[model samples]
Structures are given as structure tokens and as C-alpha cells.
Target: MNDEGAVTGRRGTRITSGSGRGLRGAGEAAKNAWRRGTGNRMVRRTGLVATMIVVAVGGIFAGLLVAGDTQADVGPFAARFSLTPSVSGDTDVQIPPLGSLGLDSHDGPAHLTVRLDTLDQDRTFALASDANGLAAASQTAAADLRHGVILLVERSIVAGLLGSLLLSALVFRNWRRVLASLGIAAVTLTATGAAAAITFKPSSIEEPTYNGLLANAPAVIGDARRIADQFSEYRDQLQRMVNNISKVYSTFSSLPVYEASPDTIRVLHVSDLHLNPAAWAVISAVVKQYDIDVVVDTGDINDWGSQLESSFADSIGSLDVPYVYVRGNHDSAVTAAAVAAEPNAVVLDNQSVTVAGLRIAGIGDPRFTPDKEADRKGGSVPEQLNASGSQLAATIAAAGTPVDIALVHDPASAGPLNGTVPLVLAGHRHAREVSFMPPVLERPETRLMVGGSTGGAGLRGLEGEEPTPLEMSVLYLDRTPALQAYDEITVGGSGTAEVTIRRHLAAGDAPGEPASPAPSAPDVESASPDPGTQASPLTSRPGVTTSSPRGN
Candidate 1:
């Protein structure tokens, strides 16, 4: 019986083991089937994610290419704004007839362009004619630009998402994948936009590269820091510009135009800009109106003569005419180098050059007093200036070519050049003056013409009881390169919007004749006429004032 039981138990154990094997085999089969199902699902999801990424990238680029542009009115300008794929990360402004200005606005594979398409003449006229029109237009334009940018961004994102969804739907014919694509696109766009915002640069506006005619317009924008800090002052400048434009338009339309003889040489004399941006607009307008052949800047073009300040000299390239420059006390070696770098600039430092058919000589100031510090050389400023003038005169004599014009920053430097050069042009006093130095030792009489602050003494003009006048002169010269007549132009600065142009004829003496000794210093009468009235021609009276401050 025990033998039988053992056999039965072994059989039972064998049966149980067989049943357990069967169960294990079934479990393995189910696990394999489950693995196969899970792998297929994972493959599908991986493909969908990859597809979504591809669709998102492709759709964004397509959208940007197709619908990444918008148009809006920017003040009197109709401007088009666009985004393009680029590594330059630049914001470019294109103004037709002028040129382009480029700024490093961000680090990106994207670039922004603002192209000024057309000017609304009617709008311009309205703005120019109305005293408050420019301010109103500026505000409106700012709002319009903001709206346009928002619209552009919105359209770009919507178009991109729609494109992605359409692509996904076409590829998968499934709502889930299409919906998934939208989420992916939104995430991608959000990441890109956040990156761009993080990299955006606002100070880039201060270091713009001006191309074409707009090259000369840099000074008009002035310092970007000032623009940001003193927006009201900037608006006031715009107002002054509009008022000047209106006055110019009205004056030219009604006045009897003086047709200069074809052989006459027209020279525009400017000085003491002191980094005033408004001066560039005035200069450009005057250059165009007078058909100026050459532009002569006496000195003090910048206030600080800093390397950064040297950028103001960039406008010299855009003047479209010969620009003869002399260094003022405020201009340093760095400033001179910057002015020399311009394509059309001629820097005269104890040297002579011929420009616009006239031989010109110039000498830089003997001192640099931007900080109002006395000269470190420990000598009289005037004496040092006279020595510098003597060196210029010697250089001119050595050159053996007759110089028609002599440029100096200070009148003291101009003193020794008297009777040596026929005309000595200078600034630095911040007031206009004209003096006739009678011929001495058989030399011809020298006419000393000092220009006032062309930039209205820049920011310093604001400190006075009254805003200093913006002054410039247009000299009409004969073929002999002799001064025949000149127009002294004064534009009321800052708070005023009046422009006065007085014509003065250089008579009573031939190009080489001796003239009567004029007053040592004559009083300069500030001319403030009705907005658009042209002053009658006046006799050549000396407008020099001895009581004026020495440095600009």
C-alpha cells in the first residue's frame, strides 16, 4: 500500500508541474502580444511628435515669408514693416530718396525692416502748417505703429498655427494629430518669441549706420539717450523742424527767386553745431535751396569732442558737396580723425586745399577747453591762437597758391591771417560777426566773417534767458572765388518758429582792393521776423561784437 501511495504522489507531482508549465506558457504568450501592441503604439506616437516638429518649423517659415509684413502710417510717412529670416539680427529703416539706417536690435535668425514707402504730401502740409499738428501726428503715429506691430505678430502666429494644422491634417487625416500640431506650434513660437524678447536691444538706436541720403540725417536724430530721457525735448525739436519746413515752403513759394549766375560759386558757411541734430536738417534744406557747391564748417561741431561724440561728424559724408572742416577747441584729434574719415570731408589743419574752385586754408584751435579748463600749456589763449594762425599763414605762403578762404575756430586765430588770406571764416563766439581788415603792407583787404552757432549752441542754448538763434550763411562768390553777396539766415531757436534771411552785398571793393577800416567790433542785431517774411537787402555793415563770450 505504501509503494502504491508513493507512485500516486509522484504522478500527482508530475501532473501539477505540467499544469504550472501550461500556465507559464500562456502567460508568456500574453506578455509577447502585449509587447507587440505597446511597441506599435509607441512608434505611432514617436512619428506624430516628429511630424509635428517638422510641420511647426516648415509652417513658421512659410508664414513669415508669405504674411510677415504690415503697412502703417508713421507720421507723414507711409511705412511698411517686415520680418525676414537672417542672422544679422538687425533692424533696418529704409527711407527713399534718403537712404537706409541699420541698427543691431537683437540676436536672432530674424531681422526687422521698416521701409518708408511714400510721403503723404497733404498730411505733411497739414502738419507743417499747424503749430500742434506734428505733436498730434507723432502721438497718432506711435499708436499706429504699435497696433501694426501687434497685428503683424498676431497674423504671423495665427498663420503659422493654421499652416501647421493644415499640413498635419493632410498628412494624417486625423483630428488628434492636427490638434497636437497646434500645441507644438504654439510652444515653438512661444519659445522663439521669448528668446527674441530676451535678446532685444534698445540702445542699438544710438549706433546706427546711415546709408544713402539718410547718411546725413544722423545728426537730426541727435543722441538716442537724450531722446529716451527727454522725449518732450525731442518732440519740441520735431515741432521746430515742422515749423521751419513750413516757413521754408511758404517763403520759397511767394518770394521772387534769385537766380544766381551759372558761374557763381555758392558756399554754405556753418559752425558751432555743438551736436545739435536740428542743424543737419537746416543745412540740408539750405544746401538744396541755395544749390550750394561747398560747405565750410569753422569749428566746435561737437560739445565734448569724445570718441562717441565723433559720430556726429558722420553727417559730413551725406552733405553731397565738398565739406571743408577746421578743428575747434571742442574738437579733438579723435574728432578730426572722424571728420577726415568721411568721403566728402576735407580736414584742414595748418594746410590748404582747393574745394569748389576755391583755395582754402585752415588751422585748428590751439586749445581744447570742453571742460572750460584753462590751457595746460600755461600761456595766453589768444597768443597761442595767434601763433597757430601764424603757422597757417606760413603754410599758405609756402604753398604759393592763393587761398580764397581761411578757416579758424576762434577770431583770435583769424587775426594773423588778416591781410594774408582774402576771407577768414571763424566761429566759437556763438554770435555772428563780420569785420573788414584793411590791406597792410600792400596785401589785399581781408574780410573776416564769423558765423553764429549753427546748432543753436546745442543743449547749452537752453540755459540762456532766450534760446540762441540758429544761424548760417550762404555766400555767393564770383568766378574769381571772391565774395559777391551773402545771405545771413537766422531761425528762431527752441521756443520761436520764425526764420529771417537777410541779403548782404559785398560792395565798394574789388577782389584785391584795399577797403576802409571798419569798426573793431560791430553789434549783431538778432533778427526775428514774422514766420515767413524775407528781409530786404541791407548794406554790408559789420555785425561783430567784442562783448560776446570767447568760447562757444
Candidate 2:
């Protein structure tokens, strides 16, 4: 050992290690102290580190629990689409996924599922704002919000009001500190921008052929602007086309009218206007043009003759001719009522009108029907006019008015009313223009007049045949006013129309001659009007008692 009791390395001298031992013993003592010191320091460090680690883990778990607890479990999910008003105060709004909404993909049905609550909220939103413009803005915002996830915080930030307010509030605090932070952030941004310019200038996106963002700026900008302009122009054109398309959206039916041999009787034939205003316009125009004597519309005039309000009357006002509308399967009592409301219009469910020397009859527009009222039917037209063919025939038999030209809307109605009349004016098969007379036991001389007029069909078939509106036939008469033939024209487009009328000469009695005597009308079944309200006959079944308006 050394004199001072210090540990020392072997140097052929007394060791610095003390404790009455040699250098080996002293080294051992020093080693023991070093081990003890190192062990204590390590223990303290480890304890601190372990404590921190455990606390960090516990804090994380607690945070997770809080977050989980705060979150509401909105189990199943569905999306809202649109809301449509129903006749009743409310409707069960049918949607996909059976009943209540649940987890589902967005791409579902042609329609969307909407909760009534969301709809009510939107209605209120539309009414809340005072500023005219701002009000519209709010409504638009609410609509967009309702269709998406609406988060108050996200909306506030996106709207910028929250950020502006926050900045103002921060100004109330350490102004210098805020300014310094802002300055530093600005410097950092500037430096970053400069560095980016230097580093990413000619980046991996470099192209050899195109000089746009990389090579040419003005040319690219010009091209982009031109493209945007063209896009806008086309978009405007598309919008215009859409509006124009709506004009004929409901072109349901068109009636064609022409004059017969006699100076008194004219003919009205029509089909598939569906009560469209455009169609009715053409119908009324054609009826007046040829001095139509009588109007006969083919079937489909009414879905079920129950509820009719295509505003056919407004168009009917132009007609001087007596209009007789037949019931197609679509025709209903309501259709009859609407038609009958016209001063000169009549509902011939399955009946005839004998004018002059011809016995003319008409049946309903021929179409099969499983449900009467299911086809977008509304109003009270049906209850006003309801009568069967038999009843109409009986009335005709009594009136004994000879019908020179039979008017019918549906070609199917022509079968029953054929033969009784020498000429038939009927409509149906809207797109079909050249319909020939069928083999009939009625009158061999009976010729069907097919009008190829647009009462609407604004466009022609791609194949170039658009002879829909002018399917009318103009029949000229000899001295006896005998049927000579007809002059016809093919009409196309919305501007001007043309009809190619063919002359129809029946029997061997020269061009126009007496065909046959008018037959007795058949019995017509009539219903009582609105049994609940007790509506009396409109006019006590006009001459010969055709059908009582009181008929249901």
C-alpha cells in the first residue's frame, strides 16, 4: 500500500490501495466503491425512467378512455337524398334497406333516403336570413351542409370568421410576442420558398415536348382561357337545350281535324297528346283550320277518366267543332269530366254521334288497365262523365242523328264503331302515320283517316320520316257531296305543318254517293254521379239522352 492509502497501479512500489492489503486488495476496495456508486446511480436513473414510462402509458390509456366515452355510437348510417311533398301531411317516404337507415354505400337507388327532420330544418333555413342575397346564401349553405357531415368547427374555420376573431383576441394579449412569431414564420416561409426555387426548379416532371408551366407560360395560359371560354359557351347551350326540351316534356296527345264532303260536318281525329299544352295548341289550331264539324280523339286521353286536369279546356276554347273524346284504357271519368266541361266537347265512352247522313260511333281509347287511379291521376273529371258504349248507342238510336264521319281517338274503338259510319277519324299510335283500314263487317266503304300532324312531335325520326302531325285527310265532294278523294301533305317540324290527305271513295255510287242508312244506337251503361254528393244530370241527357253528366 502507498503511504497515503491511495489505490495505485503496480509500479514495483507500495500500492496506493489501503486496508492492510497489497495493490490487489486496494484495487478490490476501489472496485467495490465504483460498483456501489455506479449501481446506485443506475438504480436512481432506472427508477425515474420507469416511473416516466408508466405515467406516459397510463396517461395515454386514460386519454383513450375519455375519447371513447365522448364519442357517440351512431351505429347504422344512411344518406339523405331529396324531399317531395305528398298529398297527405306526411308520407312514409320509401327508401332502400327495408326500414330504418343503416350502414350502406352511397351508390344505391335512383332516389335518395331523407329524414323528415333534415327536411324541416332546411325549410326553416330558407326563411331565416333577412338579406335577400344573404338569405339565398344561407339556404344554399344549409342545403350543402345537410347533404354532408356538418361540423361547427370546420364550418367556422372554413368561413374564416373564427380565424379572424381568434387573431383579434390574440391581439389583446402579448402583441410583441405575436409579431415576433409571425415574423419568424414569415422568414421561414420566405427562406423555404427561396430554397425550393433553387432545389426543385427543373424537377422530375420536366417534359421534352410540352412548354407550358415548365417552358411556355403565355401560350399555356391562353390555351387554358380559350378552353374555359368554350366550356362556358357549351354549358350555356346545354342549359338552353334543357329548357327547350321541357316545352314538350308532357306532349301527351294531339288531335287531327278535317272537313268532310258536306259543308256542315268536319272531322276531328287525334292521338297521344297526353294533354301537353303544346299538343293542345296544335289540336285546337287544326280543328279550326279545316272547319272541323266534329272532334274525335283516339284513346289514352285519360288514364282512367277519373281525374283530368291537363288543362285541356284552355286548348279546347279554340275549337268551334263539337269535340267527342273517347276513353283509352288511360281515359277515365275525370278525363271525361274535363273534356265535357268544354262548351262543345262530349265524352263518348263507347257511344256514337250521328250527324247528317252517317251513323258514327266511338268507343273508349283501347288500352288494358290493371289500376285506374294509379297513373298520376288527380282531380274530379271522372265523376262528371261516366257512360258505357251501350248507353251511347241507345242515345244515338233515339236521337237518330245521322253521323257522316265517325270520330275516335283509339284505333281499337274503330272496330266497334266501324261500318256504322262511312268515314272514321281516329288517333292513337302516335308515331304511326300510315294506318290502313282493317277488314270490317261494319261498312266496307269505311276509310280510316290517319293524320300525320305534330299536334306535337317536334322532332322527326333519325331516318327522316317525321310525318306525325299532318295525318289528316281532306275529303272533297261531288254534287251529291259524294266522297271523291282526299289531298294529303306530310308535315314536319314545329314551324309549319303539312298534311297529305287522300281522297276516299267508297261503293260503286261514283265518287260520293249514299252509302247506307244509319243504324239504331246501342244501349249505353251509365253510372250515378258522385253517390256521396248527389250531382244531378248536367243537362238531362241532351237530345236522345246520350249520357247524364250525373253519371259517376
Candidate 3:
């Protein structure tokens, strides 16, 4: 009986142990499966995040394409760019920045004209001079723009949908989620648009009118002439943009190339207008083409700083960029007042202003011509320049802040400022010249730059036996706030009003030194060897290259 009981117990123990081993193996297998499944889900989630990022970035690119094709209605103008299939079915498409402008006439309805000059074709038509006329033009332009944007959208969307479908089928093995993913992207984009709408503000630029100025004019034609004089800058820009579209495209390669540096600043230096209306057109073109940050006028804005010449203020006021003006010997109190009145103009004489993170200080010329008389009749130009320079230098010192640039009209005036500032820019000489002053006993080298007559020396340029060519300077600075180089541009002298660019390097700056290293005062010199100095047809030069009239 005892033997039988022991054998039975052993058999029961073996059965229980086998059952426990099987349960343990099953649990371990289940745990391994769970881990594999979790890893797969995590990978899917990561892919979704990546897709979201790609969609967002792609959406931004699409938005830019739409914006580039669309043009918002400014008060008097409507612009739109279009690319459509030609009737000939040729793929060689030349889509220019084409647009139209409206001009309102007295008592007559406003007229809308087509901008066909973009195709090298000149066609002009008239429209009514009324709000309805402008509205009609705006609607037309907007329709074309919308059509262009829609075409782009259709192409992008169709391609994206097809790609998404294929990717879904191949990756997830589920086609329905393709639509679901698209819906999610669309919702995200919609939310972004809603946020933008909530924060958008209407532009404050209003249509300019001259009702008061015309009211007091002597005759309708005379007033019209006066109005044209004041509004020529805007007209020139618009007309040139339309008619010269081909030229712009051809010369596109000549345009300034900008690098991605927040510290670098581009300056357009123009001076010695001497009441040349065409100067505005040239300066405006350079400003827009080069993406200039600020315009520095070292004085001599008018031939004689008289009240009659004050009308030139209209041109100065019309500039869309910041205008920093200093009084030249030819300027008077009335001239200064005219500049000060312009909302866009800043009178920098005996004052300083910070622009694009750089401190700029300017001093007015010593001589002021209230009437149409010259102030340098008896006193020497040099003496007057010295006096003004001394006073300005003293003022800057008292301020106890170092100025990056000092602006004056006379190059001689720049001498006193040597070692006090990094760069000194002047323009009274009516010829372009650059000089590098070596460091003196305790001061650093100062770079002096002079701009030629932006107006080609005004009427005097045409009167003299010879005329000066229209010239201007574009200054380039690096992240070190150190002068890198400059381009001296000359436009139209004897033949076609072609543009010529000459590049010059800073005198002492290494050929290609890194701007991040410790900076020292840079030396300056004309990029080219001195084409032996000659007397400028319009003004006496203090040893600088001369040019001839630019008749554009």
C-alpha cells in the first residue's frame, strides 16, 4: 500500500511542473510580440511628424509663388505678372513684371492704360479719371493674378495628391489614410491663414494729391508743369519700370549680389544734384536695383538754395527710401526747411542718426545761399570747409560716442575728421575720388570717399565746353562694419545711355580677409589706377577722375 502511494505523488508533481513551464514560455513570447508592435507604431508616428514638417515647408513655398504673381492695388497703380500658354504653343515664354498705371485728369474721368511695354511693345490707351475707373482696372489685374495663382495651385495639389496616394499604399498598405493625412495638412494650413488674417493690417500709403498746390497756380498748364516737376520721380520710376523691363532683364546679371549677413549694410551715396531732375530717376533706379538701405546726400541738392529751387523738395520727398541730407555751401536756410518738411527726409547737419545699426553724423556747409547768389565769392572754399569741419568734429567729440561715418559736402572738410571716424563721405567736388589716410601718431586711418555729380553737374554740365557723365557710388560694408569695396557707376556720356561699373577695393583691407577677425581701420583707394586727374567740365576737381554728361 505505501509503495503505491509514493508513485502516485511523483506522477502528480511531474504533471504540475510541466504545466508551469508551458505557461512561462507562453508569457515570454507574448512580451516579445508586444515590444515589436510598439516599435513599429513609434516608427509610424515619426514618419507622420516628418510628413507634417515637409507639408508646412512646401506650403510656404507655394504661398510665395502665389504672392510673387499677385499684386495688391496701390492708390493710383495696378500691377500683375502672368505666364500663359502662347497661341503658337511655344515653350519659350518671356514673362515680364508687367503692370499698368492710371493718371487722373482735371474734370475728366481717370484713364487706365495697358502696360504692354514689357514685351518691347509700346501701346498706350486712356481711361476715365474716377474711382470707378481705378476699381475697374484693379479688378482686371486681380482676375489675371488669381488665374495665375490658381494654375500654380492646381499643379502643386494634383502632384501632391498623387504622390501621397502612392506613398500611402506603398508604406502603410492603407489607401484611405492618404486622404486623412491631406485633410490634416489642410486644417493646419487653414489655421495658419486664420491667424494671419487676424494680425494683418492695411497699408497706410495713401494716394498723393496736389489740389492745394494747383489751387494757387497761375494757369492750368503752368500748374500742370509744376505738378509734373514735383511728381516726376514717381513717374520716371513707373515709366522706366514699364518701358525698361527688357533692359532690366538684359542687365539682371549686373545687379548687386547680396550675401546673408545681418551685419552688412548697403549704402547708396548721391550728391551734387545741382537741380538736375534726372538725378532723381537715376538715383531711384540705383536704390531699387541695389536694394539700398539708406540714401546719403552730402549736399548741393539744388544749384542755388533759393525758394524757387525749393520746389526740388518735391523730388526729394518722393523718394521711397530713407533720405539723409546735409547742407552744402550751395544750400540755404530755406533749402534746409524744404528738406526738413519732407516726411521721408532727415536733416543730418550738426546732428546724428542711427540707421541699420550704424551711427551716422553729418555737418552742414559753412556758407548758406539764401538768394540765388554764390557764397564763395570772396572767401576761399577751403577756409569755409575747415571752419565747418572743426565745429562738427568738436560736436562729435562732445557727444562721447564714436560715429561710424561722417558726412560733409567738401572733401577738404573731411580732413579735420581724419582719425575721428572710420569713413568720411563728401560730394561738393562733383567728381568721384577715394583716399586712405594712414594712421597718424595716435589716430587710426580714415577712409575718405567723394561722389561725382549725380545730376551730371546740372545745367552747367551741358553749358560748358564739355559735360560730366552721370555718376554715383554704391558702398559695401562687411560684418565687421569695415569698408569692403565700392562700385563707381557711370551712365551715358556720348552714345547710348549705357551703364558702366568699376569696382574698387579698400586700400588696406586684405584681398579676401575674413570679416570676423579683429578689425582695423581700412585703407581706401580708387579701384583703378588714377586715370590722370583732369578738370571736370562742370566743376574744378581736387585731383579726381572726371566724367561727361549723361543724356538719358
Q: For each candidate, what is the lDDT?
A: 0.74, 0.40, 0.58
Give one digit per residue, the lDDT tens place, for model 1 in 470-491: 8999888999878877777777
Pairs that clash in candidate 1: 99-214, 522-544
The residue ranges of model 1 lying beyond 4 angstroms of the native Cα positions read 1-238, 246-259, 371-374, 508-552
> What TM-score would you give candidate 2 relative to the actual structure?
0.39
Q: Candidate 2: global Cα-lDDT?
A: 0.40
User: How displaced is residue 380 in candidate 3, in Å?
Assistant: 4.6
What ranking of all candidate models by lDDT puts the best one first? 1, 3, 2
lDDT of 3 by residue, 1-552 (tens): 444223335545433455668899999999999999999999988987677556543543444344323332322334343322122211111112211222221111111122222211121133333425434655675465445445544443444444444444455455555555556545544543344345433231122222222221223123333343333243333333223321321222222333325555778898888887667777776777667788888988865565657878787666677888898876777888999889888898778888766789999888764322355454776787787888888888999988888999888888778888988999977777776655666787787788898877765555433446678887778756777666676654432234455555554343223212112222221222233533222211111122222222
Q: Tell me each candidate's RMSD, in Å, in order.
A: 12.1, 20.9, 24.4
Query: lDDT score, residue 40, model 2?
Result: 100
- Per-residue lDDT value at 130 in model 2: 33
Against the true structure, candidate 1 has what lDDT? 0.74
For residue 431, give model 3's deviation from the true position in Å. Answer: 1.1
